[model samples]
Target: MMPLPGPSHQPPPLHSTAKRGRPPAPISPDAGPSHCAWLEPVRNALFTSGLTLDDLVVRSGYSKTRISQLLRGNDYYPSWEITFSVTRALGLPTRPLRRLWAAAAREADKADDWIKNCIDRVVHDGEEPPLPYQAFTDDVRGVYTDYARAFLLTDQRARWVVSQAFDILWVCWNTATASENLHRYAWRLLRSCVIARASRHQDGRPDLRAAVFSTRGIRDPDVPGHLVFFTELIDLLDAITRLPEDQMDVAVLQHLCGAPHHVIARILGLAPALTRAVDHHARAALEAILTTPTPE
Candidate 1:
């Protein structure tokens, strides 16, 4: 039998183009709501706000599979895509994120509406909310500047990047968590690095690691094994050590390290076309660095 001609008056059924599948699963007890304690509330809040995982996937500009995984309660590191999408979708003001940042998940539930509560907190944060720790700035600065500098490197750019990185570390390590004592530490670290590198002509190369860490004061605590860059950064730094000096490319270094591209671009002031070239050379250098022999 022949199908009838397409509808003469009405549009064809949407099913003609729609995927064949059951409707998405609704929230179910069996789904056991993903535990990730920090993310659970955010997920619930999104669900109750006339949104769904599919909506999140579309709005967040993430792949459908990725959003599904996130809804399953896995840990999510906030990024530009998720941050911008959620904020825009919910129509959040500039400051709502701050309240969300500081409020405990349960407290978010206590409020009648998370959105209203966030707005109220934003309006009042200037008046009565406790300010973030002064040290928060230093701590954050320490982490971010290193990332910034690592991506802006050239021989000329090197010292400036080092300087910026040193600025944060110097303040964070040598001074009280409050006072920015970076001046002395910055100078000392840079000078020490220069001296160690310069003196390598004699002692077959100084122990740069020892030199870098030793200046942190007598009580200089060991850097946490997973800190700063976590595992990826540590591995990348190791890769840098083995790469040939001339082969290094800051752009490539960031990619292999999983550093954000926009951030690296902002740091280097280079156009977008350079990304692949930078990534390729940087990866090659990293591989070489991993295999380089240290002069004993």
Candidate 2:
């Protein structure tokens, strides 16, 4: 397998693509809903906190226009600095808010360093993230990242989604560890984070059409013959998306990533036999789909 790109991986600029003097374009249609979803909690917090706009301007140290735009989900996704400022002013926990902000930033296609640097500025009361959580991240971060990138189709997005998942895991570390299986709980969390951001077909199942088209790796291949394989790969990926959720997960982690069945079972917290069964069913389904004749 290819090496995962480091945090420095830079894709085309997201909201910052406009000429220097011109304001960046409005958030795309696809990103608007996600941006608003992340803001919902912040809006609720502001309402219940009984703080007025003027009060937030004073407490957050941002101009009223800036706070209003941030609250309204306008122009661009807000930076963590402003988000943390407003959330702190409202006396909310920073951990969960950071997770939401990270997700929104990824939707906006914000750079990895931009997210990290924004998060780094938040004062954690001199408290480090829990040591056990740190250890847990070290354990599954690799497979988790590859699993995500397989769906998201880019190193940058996969990294952001995984980063957000870890942020969420850190926030709920106690509950996660106390659950019946830590691996299962973390896996479910990670799965949800990726699926929530995945592009979708008209049927609302996860789709890779956008990722497959936009990815530069396929467009600029290192080998000539790889282009012929890419056509077949697209069909295979589409078929995988058509599987039931459990079967899809098993297929991707097992067949796509080359993870051993035992490792898959451990990560999914399924019995080894059941994991194999799901993979078996997934393969059978894919074969049926691929072998069926197309209409003339």
Find the candidate with the highest TM-score and give its number. Answer: 2
Per-residue CA lDDT of model 1 for 219-286, tens digit only, reads: 23464442443434444444554444322335233533344655444334344556446656777766
Window of ten residues with lowest summed lDDT in model 2: 10-19
Candidates in order have lDDT scores of 0.38, 0.72
TM-score of each candidate?
Answer: 0.24, 0.60
What is the TM-score (0 to 1) of candidate 1? 0.24
In candidate 2, the residue pairs with backbone N, CA or C atoms under 3 Å apart (3 or more residues apart, or in different chains) clash, namely: none
Candidate 2 Cα misplacement greater than 4 A, ranges: 1-96, 102-126, 209-228, 294-296
lDDT of 2 at 94: 66
**Runs in model 1 lying further than 4 Å from the true structure:** 1-144, 148-258, 292-296
Worst 10 residues of 1 by lDDT: 9-18
